[model samples]
Target: MENNMFCFQCEQTLGGKGCTRHGICGKSPEVAGLQDLLIHMLRGVGFYGQKALEKGRKIDQDTNKFVIDAIFSTLTNVNFDPERFVQYIEKAAEIKAYMKELAGEIDGVIPAAAEYTPPMTREEMLKEAKKFGVMADTSLNEDIRSLRELLTYGMKGMGAYGHHAHILGRMDDTVSHFFYKGLAATIDNSLSVDDLVKLNMEFGQVNFKCMELLDRANTETYGHPVPTEVLITKKKGPFIVVSGHDLKDLKQLLEQTEGKGINIYTHGEMLPTHAYPELKKYPHLVGNFGGAWQDQQKEFDGLPGAILMTTNCLQKPRDSYKDRIFTSSIVGFPDTAHIKEIDGIKDFSPIIEKALELGGWQEDEEDQKILVGFGHNTVLGVADKVIDAVKSGAIRHFFLIGGCDGAKPGRNYYTEFAEKAPEDTIILTLACGKFRFNKKEFGTIGELPRLLDMGQCNDAYSAIKVAVALSEAFECSVNELPLSLILSWYEQKAVCILLTLLSLGIKNIHLGPSLPAFVSPNVLQVLVDNFNITPISNVEADMSAILEAAATA
Candidate 1:
């Protein structure tokens, strides 16, 4: 079998056309098709599953887990293993069959698509897609249809995050139901672009709830995040750098390495773990090791520590460190060591042992601390002071310059936008994309730091909390405040966050690095007409636009 595969679900694909032979991320055609089938089936399951639940039907955890995991499995650079995806396909079929059994007359299953096989014909694949809720067939308007598709993609992203949270015993019924609702809505022909726009906001509303639930699960289990500095340089010896968003995996790693003398460091989204009281309590938890997800090939190569990926935002691994990488839960890389579930808890002793055998830096190296731990609690803790700063006119503007980063060079717009921000502004950042500006010292305004790090992508919840708090303090809506959201997106997680923002009725958001490949023209118009969603211009132009709008208003 050839080692390469093809996929085009992400914004950057071969030729802006469908990937035919091998995906940029190294996925083969088999894996790509399987991932599509998995997503198509998820839509079907979500359609029937939501209806079943509404009728007071109770769905089992396995069925729920399957739906969640299946979506997460399709994210960029997340799943590269064909065997694992094949299993997911089987699992999806199982769930669909189970739901059909329960419902007696399932509406979303397309018979021709249900029995399709791999190395499948394009015709067969297209027929199978018909079963996936039909992409808002009732909406004749292109804009409405496009927006519906965009919203659907966003829900898929949110569902993926929600699923990760669910695996750790954190389940939100509202979030789960929305997945069903959104799918069912796709099948509803009466939905207008206006209706879809409203649903778009609901996507955000549900995502907000989902984020809160995950936040509660994380803080409750790990304790609230606290401010702490992380080290950037790698120390020689045996160590493992854990990245992405799964604290459960981090906790397990910590427990396994308690007395083993292997050092642990958080990378990317995991950087904020330093703020959590419980996870931070570990002495061996050393510091942060790398930058954003896109920089992983350079960061992880020739490193002394093993790399553990817990969730999405995973990049293609470089050959240098490929053998040393491990993935757990829904993440899968071809041929890498996958941490399998054992007795409901994954034992990461292999990663730990590898770290010990590698023998990290022998001599104590110069340690540096990078500040993190500013999740919602950390921000809320200082909300009163933040409110004061804004009231006193000390913090002139609040710029939320965070979202997914892509390979596009134009994405440097985020860095420039932040760089060109007014002196009195404060920057709130989250997700992997923040790496572009995170290392830059923007100094401070008044007593507050100009750049405030808000943990991982899910920590967008923190930004909302702060925004709502500001709104309450000022006796105005969130839109009334002197805040602007300049987002850079490349994946589905960003989709859900945008939906959550819309749900809050927050408008005039500037999104860039191009919109989703899936959104049709009609949908783009709806987003622009209703939400004031605009593409990112040059940094200077965007900054001026943001500031000019504030000044004029």
Candidate 2:
């Protein structure tokens, strides 16, 4: 069959290859094409932005924010509306024009992507989009193409972190400038494989800073995450279930819904919000609702309360609850209610009214709670105990089994690996992947629970911090420590996190359920040779091998 659109940026792409027709996340070919076009225009912006930077011109904060949000919207399952992408393409053209004017008298050659004008009409834009997708430049070598896509996807993830940070009033010029440079590199034919590899690593380093910036923004704005127990059961009242990874949006909603007789519950990535002191202070901020984002359609169907999606990981809403679902902050879907920010504040009163209309659950269910808020501050606050446990062999091994979760078959490896881990091991988890075995009772090793739930995926910074601290105390490199990262990746955010790990010279990361299709065999070999990156084989074999390696080391 002829290909309609090509995208392999996510782990759950069709057949573990490209999504040639429609996205597995319910995005149509038309929407995918428009997203491709939008990315192309953003590259044009980046190209000019780079030239401006070389001329000692500072790119304004507005352009930086626009680029961040635009790139973030192209992430898998973030925005699937074709019209919204068209709007973004138009804005990108405007920004590219502004950047081009700001960057005059360029010295070097300009690529076609830097100077092309976008088509005016939607049909023409869609037609134009087909020429700029993943397979657009077939003349490049397969390995180079793979590396470029890898870098582009990494930047997409960086943009996501940058967007969240920007939302919280945090800005970093170095991080913003790297976005332009990295995006430009994807189209720079003069860059060699080595140059691209170095750029990828540099981008990874910068992304680590970006993640740190986001961590600071979250903690400073909401206060450091404490070890708080979050109730997961339903309560009898009008309620709103907030999903995705935006704490600011959830905070605003909590403020808006205060005393309005609507309780707020978190879903997916937002479950960690309950750990924040500023957010958890709200009396009506009750608990978490569902598990990960992949199960939202079934989880939200016929639900009593309204649902708010603050960021990505949005699937196509089912008809049963589409009317009650709302999108905000760069997440969009056709025909769904979107809460737009007016005067720098999002009015979630629509969602509030919808919740009141629905009347929520009829009766309070039995209370069930899950523990969260084990961020760097929380974990490191008790570092002496953790160090003592390690020294005494009370904690024999440390397993960081976390990343993006998906519906693919092999993801069961993460659950089994966590379940079968020896009693002496400490499992550190983050992101929605924790939903796999979070509810399982893993008894404590001393005072700390065996399964430590570090905040969200971006909170991987927390895990890194703890690892570096442990390595410091043990007088060894992070790799030399008895730690293993068996991660499950589903999207670009996970890609950037993995890059951060590889850039830190951290080794022997077991990533699955499948490797990214965009990673050509040659590029994959580079990763394996340099970082000892391995694909997860089976729960038993991988676990045994990891334990044996730790034991011998």
lDDT tens readout by residue for model 1, 1-553: 3333434456666665446667766666666666666666666676667668866888877677667677777777778887787677666767766775665555554433333333344435434433333232454565755665666677778866787678669886777777767866665667787788778877888888888888888878878888777777666557889988888889888988888778898888788887788888898888887788878888887777788998876777888888788898888877788999887799887887777776766666777655676777777788888888877888888999998777766888888888888888988888877888888888877666788888888888888998898888889999889999989887778888888887788899998777666677767776788789988878887788778888786
**Winning candidate number (lDDT):** 2
Estimate, for each residue in 1-553, the C-alpha lDDT of model 2 and write its tens digit.
1349999999999998899877898889988888888889988888999999999998899999999999999998888777898899999999999999999988879988999899999999988988999998778799999999999999899989999999889999999999899888888999999999999999889999999999999999989999999898889989999998999899889888888999999999998889999999998999998899999999999998899999988999999999999999899999989999987799888999999999999999999988998999999999999999988989999999999999988888898999999999999999999999998999999889999999799999999999999999999999999999999999999999988999999999999999999999999999999999999999889888988988888
In model 1, which runs have C-alpha deviations exceeding 4 angstroms? 1-8, 15-21, 105-148, 187-195, 362-365
Instruction: Report the error of model 1 at residue 353, Å.
Output: 1.9
Q: Please list the C-alpha lDDT of all candidates, in the order they appear.
A: 0.76, 0.92
Best by TM-score: 2
| TM-score (all chains, Cα) for each model | 0.90, 0.99
